[model samples]
Target: MKFLATCPKGLEPLLVDELTALGAEEVKQTASGAEFSGSLESAYAACLWSRLANRVLMPVTEAVVETAEQLYAAVQEVDWSEHLDQSGSLSVNFTGSTKSINHTHFASLKVKDAIVDQFRDRFNCRPSVDRDQPDLRVHAHIYRGRLVVSIDLSGESLHRRDYRTESGAAPIKENLAAALLYRAQWPKCATEYPSVLDPMCGSGTILIEAALMKADVAPGLLRSEHGFERWKQHDAQLWQTLLDNAQQRREAGLASLEPVFFGSDIDTKVLNMARANAERAGLSAFITFERRDVKDMAPPNEAGGLLVTNPPYGERLGESSALMFLYRGIGDALKSRFGGWRAAIFTGNPDLCQAVGLKTDRVYKLKNGPIDSQLFLYTLYRKSAEQLAQAEESESQELSEQAQMFANRLKKNLKAMRKWVKQNDIDCYRLYDADIPEFAVAVDLYGDWVHVQEYAPPKSVDKVRAFDRIKDVMAAIPEVLEVPLSRVVLKQRKRQTGTNQYEKQGAKGKFFEVGEAGCRLRVNLHDYLDTGVFLDHRPVRRMIQQEAAGKDFLNLFCYTATASVHAAVGGAKTTTSVDMSATYLQWAMKNMAANGFSDKHQHFIQSDCLVWLKKQRKPQFDLIFMDPPTFSNSKRMQDVLDVQRDHVELIRLAMRLLRPEGKLIFSNNYRRFKMDYEALAMFDVTEISAQTIDPDFKRNTRIHSAFEVRWP
Candidate 1:
């Protein structure tokens, strides 16, 4: 018998080796599968033992098919009675297409028509189409106008391990997961019965496959039937012998299986699914499932084991930044906890894998459904404390010539800024703001904590080299600044669009108190891209305080209401803060309450800043801070706002509500902002961008632009 074992793309070589190992002869590899010469028993064994094969096919016939009629005629020549009785149920799975057949479903129907017509004309009975549990599962492939028809020995694709009735978010196909484990050398490890773990195991696909391999259980053992079972030439005795041998091996293997299998997921529901899947796989007693976050995962016991998982890839919308943090956390946890263990990470995003910190020893290319992915293998071993300290010293000395220069520049910047920060009584100020162009992160000290925002490198920069440079900076910052690693928060700063600024990046809602200008404000480091307070806005907030005394102050687009709190602290008679987001408004209220400014006179209103500005009766404030977003198309807004185009009208509207002596501080962070001097010629407009920028943000002088407008 000639058997073909089909698999996913890029897995043909592995499938070929697997088929050869399973007693297949004359094995020849193909693009997505392999063809081999073997007996009926070998074909049966392939269906049961070949983990990577999607299905085992027995070719019935082949012919040229230039059109749909030709395809039907060619399929009709296969002699259907040999595989299925005329009354038995059957199904056809058509793949590929020709010029005459553009859709697979149409091709499948044509083949079904041919088989039904042939049976009806000869035996006066036609097989009914049974898509589910078909007595004869026919597979037809058309490539370059030629068709080959075969019977699917495996009733369904072998990926369906029959154990996973439920799956978590973005589940990987079982066969692909098995390939990843194979590439990780888990099969070899199974012989030793070494421990196995999936820290981010969504539904235990990897753990179950590992257990099956370790227990010498056939992949198809759980299935009640295969497509060949109902055939007229079926070998019942041979199959029973194979089954009995498999069952006996499973019993013997399970008795001596020493490797402990552990699975953990952050979500308990997914962990429960894993437990149920293990139970259905008949390996429940040998595996342990727990609910634990990836970062909290530690070695199950003292014995080193294989740590493997398929972590999220951020392919979904609005998940890149969060997944980046998750990957970084996973790396950190592995570095701190999983010493002397072998690790493998399967991810669709290789860029995210770079953030894992650990070096990869090997990488295997594979596909997860349609997404191309990689499995990275590494050995997690940590040096002793003394050796680590020595390595640190060696790394510092081994810094490249360019990196040494960058480090020296950072040292110089920090030395120059210390006296100024001390004089200003600022606990949090920029110590290094990209002093070296090669190092593009702006480092700031938030009390004892360090907040570093990595500026996106330009297209001309080598990203890999840039990432290495960034790592150098991160490693040097804690040592140079003498701060704990936990106190360092690194975030990538990217350009925002629409209401991305208003979106919550994390759900932690963890906040810490930091003192600024004699005011205690809550700063959230984990929740948003912008830390609760803008460090560059220190001078601007101070200017607001100096100008706001015994006056009605209005703050537009008041994010977190930091500016309003500053105005109130400077003794504003009445303060009103308006923003579009209820979330930010709530945060604003908390900031005010935190600063002992909870009086009713301090108000926060959730409304579109533009609409609210138009509704203000007249001259309602002596001082107004109207710093709108650079661009906004929020659903709650009446219209899209482009600061460059609408600044003239925006300033005019504010001037109408400004008293003759009142000042409107209009500000934006648009990189290139030009004020319409001719349109607002009636009012006195003075650009204070230079004076408002703190020393920390002086390098990027356009970090924000502020102008004081008043009606004379």
Candidate 2:
């Protein structure tokens, strides 16, 4: 008889070895499973003792199938009475697709119809379909033009070990946990150390699987059901003998089990779940569950053992920054505590894996549900005090010359900005802006935190070299700027279009307050590419404050209402802020309330500035400030905005709202922006860009262009 043993992806080779050990012949590996030819005892043993296999399938028949007619004919070829009678229930699982049969549901229905029609033709009645607990489960796979059908020998997936009644959020599947243990060589390590631990063990999946492996207990013994129980060919006598042997082995194995297992989680609720699950698995005496954080995890005994854990991967955007600190803490704990032991960390985010700051001996790619994950294995070896000091010295000396130069330049820039920042009581300012052409990054200081944005390199630059330079920048920032790794937030700045700039990078929802120009502004460093406050606009906001007293102020494109807050603080009679983003408008309201300016006199309008200006018929403001993006094609706008081409029309609309004596200050960050002076000859427009460059932004003089427009 030929059979197939199915498992998760990346565990096929292990399944092949397992099947071969269980008295199977010609065991060959395939995608997500293994195929072999064996006797009934061998097949039954695979369904009983195989830990990695998800299901044991016995092939009934196969045929060339292309259309629905061909599929029905193929399934009808199998004798219906030989496997399942008219009184039994059956289920069909169909996978893969062809051009003729595109949907799995349609294909499965055809197979079911063929079997039922055959049974009706032989007898007077047909079997009913039972999806939940079928007496016989038929598995079919179609690829290209071939169909292979088999009987599912294991009713449920092998991962359902029947032990876990409750699980925590994003629990690792049992089969994947077993695969990780196999990759970490836990079977061999158990004989040597006789101990195991999981710092982030939710529901105790890994620890329970490890205990089963070490105790010589069959993974399927706990399950009360199997697919072969109701089949016509099931051997009750042979199965009972195998079951008796398994029962005896489990009893003896538990009595002599010497290995100790420990599991811990920061969440007390998950720890409780783990305890309940262990109790159900009948291994509660060998395992200990504790409520402990990863940072506080230590060795359970003086004897070192294997430490395996699956940490959260921060699946949401904007979460990696916070998770980086968690990964760093895990690394610190492993280094400080678990010396002369082996450790395996599983995660879906490989970038977060680098935060561990440990070199891996092996990395195995596996799937955790839909996520492509990796198991990073490390051999922890403790260093002597003198060796640690020498290692630190060696690390500093290993810096590339380019990195050393970047560090020195950062020190130089900080020295130049210190006195200016202190004298002006500045809480946020630009510290460095691409001073070294090779190192193109903008470093800004927001109070005590540092925000770094790396300018996207040109296509002409090699990607490898560009990434290396970025690494150099990251390494130098914390050392030269005197900040911790967690305080340094790094982002890559690229040319954005179609509201991409406003898109979220993470979901941290963390905002900090920074004082600027006598106004408190809320800024988020992780969630978005650009922080709430623009440092180069310090002088621009200051100018708005000086000219805003006793005048009705209108702010266009009022992102986060930073400029409106400045104008309101400058004693504007009424401030009306307009923008197309409700998110930013809400943020604008928060900024107003943060400054204790929540009266009805201050309005936040959520609309395109162009459309809002077109609806106004009379002069309603004495002072106006408009700072538009270079290009926008957002769907909410009636039309696209190109600053250079649309400025004349945009400014014309704003001037209609301005009084005859009112001043309209316009600014944009387009580097090559050209004003339509010939088109707007009715207004006197003087360029005030140079005057808006504060001490901090002096080097980047063309960072923005500002103009003062008035009646000629």
**Largest TM-score belongs to which candidate?**
2
Badly placed stretches (over 4 Å) of model 2 are 39-44, 81-91, 116-136, 162-172, 198-204, 221-248, 262-300, 309-339, 345-415, 434-441, 453-510, 526-529, 546-558, 571-586, 601-688, 702-712
Clashing pairs in 2: 317-506, 317-507, 318-506, 318-507
Instruction: Compute the lDDT for candidate 1.
Output: 0.84
TM-score of each predicted structure versus truth: 0.72, 0.79
lDDT of each: 0.84, 0.88
State which candidate has the highest lDDT: 2
Model 2 C-alpha lDDT per residue in residues 313-426, reported as the tens digit of each score: 875433444566578768867776777789999999876777787889999999887889999999989778887677557655755889999999989988988898888899
On residues 320-430, what C-alpha lDDT tens digit does candidate 1 reach at each position?
Answer: 444666777788777767777889999998878877888999998888888888889988886688866665566457556666677677778888788888788887777
Scored against the true structure, residue 510 in model 2 reaches a CA lDDT of 84
Instruction: Report the CA-based lDDT of candidate 2 relative to the real structure.
Output: 0.88
